[model samples]
Target: MKLCFQNDNICVYSLKDWVKLRKEYRIIGEYLGSSQATPTLPIKLLPEEAIFLINKNVAKLIQYPKLLVEPTDDCFKEYNKLQVDLQQAEQKIYKEYRKKELKPYIDKIVIAKQRKLNDSVSTSSVLNEELNRMKVTQENIIWPTLTEPLDCVKGESIEVPKSILMKRTTPTKILVFTDLWEKGYYVTCGKKFGGDFLVYAGDPIAFHAIHIIRCIEDPLKPLHTSELVAFGRLGTSVKKKSVLATKTNETVNYITINWLDL
Candidate 1:
């Protein structure tokens, strides 16, 4: 798998590898592409995710030079031409379909219009002309689904660098994630829930997250009362249990906090 380092995140550019990682390995990386379109190639992995994959020998970390290049005038022209050609081809096919499918409806419309006008206009000609000049609405246009796999970039493999290490995901966080993942739970970033990781009983798509995990790096450290209350409230509001996971030299421990309202 091509693990390209881009903008402090490890990215997988190959669609095949991304699908395999997500479906088989349960490594659900965030898709950084357009939200309007179905997710395609190029998914950015969190720091913890990249580290886990690297440690497990699932993917190698690499520094790829020339990751982005400026397109030339010819490239822009070719792209524009391709877009136009696709539009034309789709329009042509849809026009034929509309002519056939909408024939009865259009004929009825033409006949009614002629009757209202009390004229001898041919409905066939009118229907033909209307269908020929019909404009395809945005809803009628179908966007192509991109399922093709792209060529993976082979960059120079290097040891995990300091720059890739994020302050948000500490060693303890990784340990917590690894522990939960090894125990048959699907773990994902929990920034949305104001936690370190969200743990699911099974595949995330099939089951709702069961716990919002926050890792305490120091086993002896205690969370402030307000912080603990807030974390518990957040989990309650999101319909999940709040869990504080702390790691000692030998093992990791988890404590679930339940917020009760009187």
Candidate 2:
């Protein structure tokens, strides 16, 4: 089972799990790690989203009951030793690889230098010294590592009960979201669109949002005319339908609001 970690909040730390969730399940969660403007993983799942995944048996939520133990003095020493070892290993591999790549170039350079010396005042000792110096200069060249940080670190899964997951989000919001999701629409948080969710017919990136969905927990609750007009006008401006989603018993209902110029 794919495991999502629950720290301060529920999040999918693994890039593989996140890709599957978005591509397969159409669960597009917010990327909330380093560089929000230019987002990188791990992505954060909304409470409703987390609960939906749990209910569907798509993923298991794991909660760390206690904070990770702080590193001991010995641990720091071991880590520094490991870093030094890694640097040494990298340097050795880099030298071998670079030597092979730069061999032809170095040969060309050495030949040119020898030809220049031959034209001027060439001696066997002087030529040998020049070649040795060139080789040493080439060997001293340092290149940066191409390695990237690991996507996620695997840890022991501490299974959080389904009942506990249920407590994280409101039932009405889940019901509305699940209904839309089951209908094959891609849904993402619609705060920017001034709604609870932005519903797209296909991949959110490829298609324009079809609906700006606002979840209404109480179907019978009264909404002000101004609020309705604002939603409708905003939706029209963005070329999307404003939809109010609510649940009556177990059935979810959608009401579309259209703004008219008249």
Query: Could you tell me which 10 consecutive residues in candidate 2 have the lowest summed lDDT?
Result: 143-152
Whole-model lDDT per candidate: 0.75, 0.73
List model 2 lDDT by residue over 137-203, tens digit each: 2234332221222223344447767666667667888888889899999888899999998899999
Candidate 2, residue 68: Cα displacement in angstroms equals 6.1
Residue 33 deviation, candidate 1, in Å? 3.3
Clashing pairs in 2: none
Q: Which candidate is the best by lDDT?
A: 1
Off by over 4 Å in 2: 34-37, 65-154
Clashes of 2: 0
Superposed by TM-score, candidate 1 places the C-alpha of residue 133 at a distance from the truth, in angstroms, of: 9.1
- Candidates in order, TM-scores: namely 0.76, 0.66
